[model samples]
Target: MTAHEERPNEPILLRRDEGGIATLTLNRPQQFNSLSMAMLEALIGAIDDIARDESVRAVVIAGEGKAFCAGHDLKEMRSSHALAFHQQLFRLCGRFMMKLTEIPQPVIARVHSIATAAGCQLVSMCDLAVASENARFAVSGINVGLFCATPSVGLSRNVGRKEAFEMLVTGDFIDAREAQRRGLVNRVVPPDELDAEVERLCASILAKSPLAIRMGKQMFYKQLEMGLDAAYQLASETMACNMMCEDAGEGIDAFVAKRKPEFRGR
Candidate 1:
């Protein structure tokens, strides 16, 4: 797959192909795709749209230019009215992040360059992430006197507490390989191979029953916060429910018949 040629007039570009994959590209590369108020609103809107869209089975979040996102727009934060804007801005940002968990569609982050501060938080929010080998990641807000409080929620959950703390405190960059070791990303490939790798991964997921994939993703996150016993209990309950779905029945029948299953996603 070639890099998508973006068209003009596409703010928070949304494109869906025949394969049920939806790609959302951040369109503000002029500022390193910084998270300005407008961009934040656009992103939230796009995610909301995808959540409600049945045609979109898998979603990929990518940036328009070199950087995935540079985090919050520093220029906006430096305005004279910064103090007055924090509450509203944080509320929107927090809500946008939380929405990622609520959505049933599997979301992937296609990271090509640096994902810093909130950008890094965005990566952590994704169900899966594939990065270019040259990509650099950091929670660099602390160095600027702003703690990456929100990012820590996702980062700490993925990586060890000590490792998360080290990145947060030092605001140092970590290469893609270390990011994979730390569980920040699922895989790393060359920049030229990023699109193909992401497409390959998404296609694998798309081949599964949509309902199964949706419920599985939901249960995965829910069980993450539960005790082992509680998690097992939840998993058992979810599996029972999944087995009752039409797709599950078809899958079982197909296996017995030695034929490929055609799932209707019921």
Candidate 2:
């Protein structure tokens, strides 16, 4: 049974925090955690809250139940045959995907099962992704006669243009290992090891200086959109500013003195 079928009153999105990681679980299990309008709104709100929270050093987006996510709620879309509604829905989804990159903390996708169409787009938009060996990915909207235009935006950015276009047109699923090889995910482990792997990735990010992570994340995405010379100029300026931070100085001193650095997040 889907999460909604089991508990109709439960929140469609659930947030839990432990250590420095904030995990957002998509809660529509019966619907395969499809991105309905309400789900999109809840995610945007949670992401906005996390963006301002200095304590949240990292985020993991996961889905509850059988699938990570199955893309848009087709039932909901069919419920409203209005063009304006469809336009609004895609616009909201695009905004949420963009926010994942804009946030200071790194967002990692925890894909336990299938992630298709907009669901695949979610994985692509995240800073990193760790999937189970049993996981599958696809942008399969073409199967239903609709092109996954918005999903293609993130898909193209993550993988080669030809590879992404092939998926768009074929509506074929790629296994976890293949997805990793194609640059869609960072790691693929056994199903039983999924949680452990995600936590391990999170631990690595949490060990870094928070200020450096924040600054580096912002600079990272910004530089990706710039020309080579402009990108270097921005990177140089960022490095100079980062070097002036107290954490940077302490890190260098500790490295030379053979001691661990205690970063105050300045």
lDDT of 2 by residue, 75-171 (tens): 9999998999999999999999999999999999999999999999999999999999999999999999999999999999999999999999999
Q: How close is candidate 2 to the true structure, as a TM-score?
A: 0.97
Candidate 1 per-residue C-alpha lDDT over 1-266 given as tens digits, one digit per residue, 9 for 90 to 100: 12222324545454555589888887778778777777677778778888888888998989878899889888887774756588777777788887888798998999999999999999998889999998999999999999999889989988999999999999999999999999999999999999999999998988899999889988998998999999999999999999999999999999999999999989
Q: What total of clashing residue pairs does each candidate reach?
A: 0, 2
Name the lDDT of candidate 1. 0.87
lDDT of 2: 0.95
User: Largest lDDT belongs to which candidate?
Assistant: 2
The 10-residue segment of model 1 with minimum total lDDT is 1-10
